[model samples]
Target chain A: MIEVKELVKSYGVTGVLRGLNLTAPNGQVLVLLGPNGAGKTTLLRILATLTKSDSGTATIHGMDVAKNGELVRQSIGVVMHSPMLYGDMTVSENLAFFARMFGLPSPDRRIAELLQRVEMDRRADIRVRLLSHGQQKRVALARAMLHSPRTLLLDEPESGLDQRARCILEGIINEFRSADRSVIMTTHQIELGLQVADSVAALERGRVALHEPASAIDIAQLQARFSEPTEALGAL
Target chain B: MAEFHSERGSGDQTETAPTSEQQDSGSPGVFVASLGVIWAIARKDLLLELRNRDVIVSIAGFVLLVFAIFTFAIDIQQADNAELVGPGVLWAGIAFAGVIGLNRAFSLEMERDTLEGLMLTPISRDLIFLGKALGNLMFLAISIAIALPVFAVLFNLVVFRLELLAIAVLLVIGFSSVGTLFAAMSVRVRAREIMLPLLFLPVVAPLLLASIEATADLVAGDSWSEMSQWLQLAIGFDIVFVIVSAVIFQFILED
Candidate 1:
């Protein structure tokens, strides 16, 4: 679903991604577990075609993300911070706009189905600004799914959600895999990430320090590896 | 149906999935669909403005207050020669209000971080520029409508003439063309509010001078045919600036 190699991205002297390579195949969720400033967001942005890498090759399926950005955009769904939704528009209005943009057929029916799936049908008419943070987050989730994207890239989906909201997020991720869609997500939560992810990896110092199946690794060891800084980071 | 298709170092066969973009782009009604995206973006902005009433109301209030103050402070109303002063005061007030409106064009996107969402749509940046510039132009036009009667009464001048309307449209279109581009650039920097006017003054110096002079001529009873050169200059700049700004805007908005 996603393939990246030698992705070196930097901001002036401060490097964010250094020779990072990772992959997430179809029908699975890949969770990137990392500490603060681990370049997880930058990696996702590259895959989402929201930002360019300084050097390296990253492709979704086979299309180069930088060269075929328009095609890549048409295939993937993205969830970033703060919902990325207009506060003044109603939830339904927001979905309808994207639906039209995606050239979705039968948009009203699709909007209804997504809203019902997210348990947000009751509040579809309410303005986004009036909703609580969790509700707005749910709307954001629905908006991302409105186009039925094949690859889902979410950056920190569990940041401020309540337990119920987190469960909905996990359910959505699971549903993606069940439908043969691939998922790439970044989070610091070990237990929650492992529960939903089929594969797990840790990014440190702009490099992938570890990549393994979630079922193979011991949780405690995984936590320890993620928490400590690597002395080999500078050398790499 | 939406699986990824990649090209590796060597020839390799992978599961081929068709791209919907080719289908959509090749369809018979693509032009209409493109227009739909443009109108959707512009409509969202206008609706947001209508709901908040921030930019238009504040701009109108500020411009009207400036006009009234200039009328009293400069005594343009009592001048034995109001024409000489009226155009200067009018353009200054309009220019100030226009800048404030333009500055909000991209700051609102930055405020909500909705820019990334727009980018992900893969809509052409040229269309984004057109939609935003149109929205800015509409807001300025609304402000002008609200301020005109009050401006005329305060300065004791006739702002209802056809030539005045023509000059106003040309000025607003020219300002919006350049202002939208600068506003997009300035919002990415710190101190965007101060940055907006500073970037604006130098770029629009010639346009503003022509605008003020032309307004002075019309107010001084010069016929449109007589001031054809000034009108032609404004029209020419409007064409060149708008096209140039639209072309250059995509570079400024790069991720």
Candidate 2:
């Protein structure tokens, strides 16, 4: 389980997250819905142990995100909008490099299996520079899952992907769910989020405007919640 | 069928059991794994350079050109002073070529966003710095190997002396060590092409002077005892800069 209590994060003079609280239990997908500059990326980066929070406590399972960052990194996998892939290397080589960095047991087989899972086995030998944007995204996805992490934090995983690529991604997320892994993804694709997310949290002015299960809210309610304009308020 | 394939794919009997140990010990294995990561990055760079031949070729060509220019400017054959001036000419060639290679080495990473991917991995930033430094050192060594013979042939100097060889190694170590660290820092800054040489040359001036002096003594056929003090200074510079660079590289990289 992940519990964020009174989380507060600021950039210079501006506060992005203001006493925001959220909870996500195991075996559930929580989609954070918000428009631009809603602090969605900031919140996810903090959760992924890439950025720091000014004042708050985020605990993954029982470990504190700030105090026990290495532990948090070990348990979580993050796939941001940027592919974070080396263009000069082959697809399988990229996966193997990451797996080796994390010291995965049997990295060779793990890399091969991930390639097959992402359905990039046929192009595994080709340099990433030759692959399309969507193919690179698949490789990035496989790279993120190399360690079999428990918590998956994806920021715009479906962005820039075609319909076929979107289906491949949805299939991977469903696989994560069946493995009993917890996932938190932020996406603008409301239809895709509705199809897979078990719960949804909408953010406005760095606060949770709506937090409920997907079954509890219909499409109209979600649209209304997301479309509400944020007031220009000073930092808390 | 999917489940069966997943189970068989893992090949571990404990595939059904949870990997609780890994979760409990979050980073115990990471430190050891970092060594492998460092080796892999350096190996990849080395292999790529070997295949493409751009860095090596450019460096060698640049060194040869510098030597040729110096030969015309200095009139080596007319004067019996070739031996006295040979060391300065060789170091000038190496230093100029070293800067070019260092700049190109780092630009390779910047061109493709490879450095970003490397940084996102769960390894210490220092290891990344070290790996790149090692790669630069190897490339510089190769450049020296090709240039040293050309220098001997062009200047009509005997190149097979043990003292000369040792002094060459020391000079290479001093030049490339500082070059690698400064190159890593400068590559990320704005206007990096102009910034790298400006940042590197000033900081590395003392080592360069010391190397040129030591090499001049060796080429003059001075005894080891006579040149020992200068050699110590060169060694001291290399050790100090390498340690300081390793400690401060993480800060630069983070910024």
Candidate 3:
């Protein structure tokens, strides 16, 4: 479980997250929806321990992120805007490096399994620089899933994924949910995000404008919420 | 949607494979774990260099170019000033070439945002610094090893002495120790090429001075006692740089 309270963050004079509160329980997919500069990536960065909040508390499995960063890192996998991969390294090599870092007992076996699952086993020897954007995204996903992190924090994970990789991604998220793990992903793909989300939360002006079960909101309503003016959702 | 197979395939799951809980239950000692992380990072760097040959090639080229230019400009055949200018030329060549290696030490990580990937690992930040520093030291040592003979032939000087080799090692150590730290700090800057030297050169100046003095004394056929003071200063600088840089590396890496 991941819980955040009163999270406030800023850059220079610009505020990104302002006393924001959120909770993501285990065994569910919480899709975060927002426009540009809406603090989605900033929020993920804080949760991933890449960026510290100016003031607030974020905990994963009751371990404070600020105080227990390494512990929190061990429990979470992050896929940011960039693939976060070494372009010069082959797919298998990249996974092996991360596996060793994670101190996995059987890296070769785990790497082979992940490569096959991600449908990149055939291209295991190909360098990341040689792969297409979608292919690289697949490898990035494979890298993220290497350590079997309990929480997967994906930011714009579907940006370059083709239809087949999207299916693979959906399958992976479903698998995580089935295993009672938590997935907190941010995306602009309304249909795909809603399709796999157990719940949806919309962010406006560094605050949660709306939070509800996925069943309570459809594509049209979510689109309307996003397209409508920010002032209209002030009371939300 | 096609079903993605389970992570644990029938033949893929092994008893040797440890879960997170199992890993915690039978974890190695902290020292061993740190060594493992450091080795993993360094090996990755070595492999990347082997594949592309960019960093080593650039460093080797730069060092050789410096040596060639210095030999012509100094006109070492004059024989009277060989000892005086030889040590300066050698150290300058190495100092500048070392910067080339140091610049790539972290910029490679920045190119594809792999540094953040590294930061996400469970390993401590100091281990990352040590690993990169170790890799940089090895690259500099290798480049210098190759360049020394070339330098000797060009300058008509003997650089194969034990004392000189030891001084070279110290130079490499001191350069990489602080170089890696500043490299990480300046990697994100837009003009990192300019920023690295601006941040690194001044700090390493004293160590360079000691190394040059020791090398000059050694080349001039002076007794050990004559150069002993300079060697001590170099050694002291290396020790302090490595410790202070390693301790504060975490801050340089943090946002």
Q: List DockQ for all candidates.
A: 0.30, 0.24, 0.41
> Candidate 1 regions off by >4 Å?
A228-236, B1-28, B77-80
What's the residue-level lDDT of A169 in candidate 3? 93
Look at candidate 3 and tell me the lDDT of residue A142.
Answer: 84
> For every model in order, what is the iRMS?
9.0, 6.6, 5.8
- DockQ pick, better of 1 and 3: 3
Question: Measured with DockQ on alpha carbons, how good is candidate 1?
Answer: 0.30
Tens digit per residue, CA lDDT, model 3, A149-217: 778999989888877898999999998899788899998876777889999888888888888998898
TM-score of 1: 0.90
Best by lDDT: 3
Q: A230 in model 2: Cα distance from truth in Å?
A: 18
Decide which is better by TM-score, 1 or 2: 1
Q: Over 4 Å off in model 3, which ranges?
A: A228-236, B1-28
Q: TM-score of each candidate?
A: 0.90, 0.83, 0.92
lDDT of each: 0.79, 0.75, 0.83
Q: Under the 3 Å rule for N, CA and C atoms, how many clashes does model 3 have?
A: 0
CAPRI grade of model 2 = acceptable
lDDT of 1 by residue, B116-168 (tens): 77777655667678778888888888898999889788878876989888888
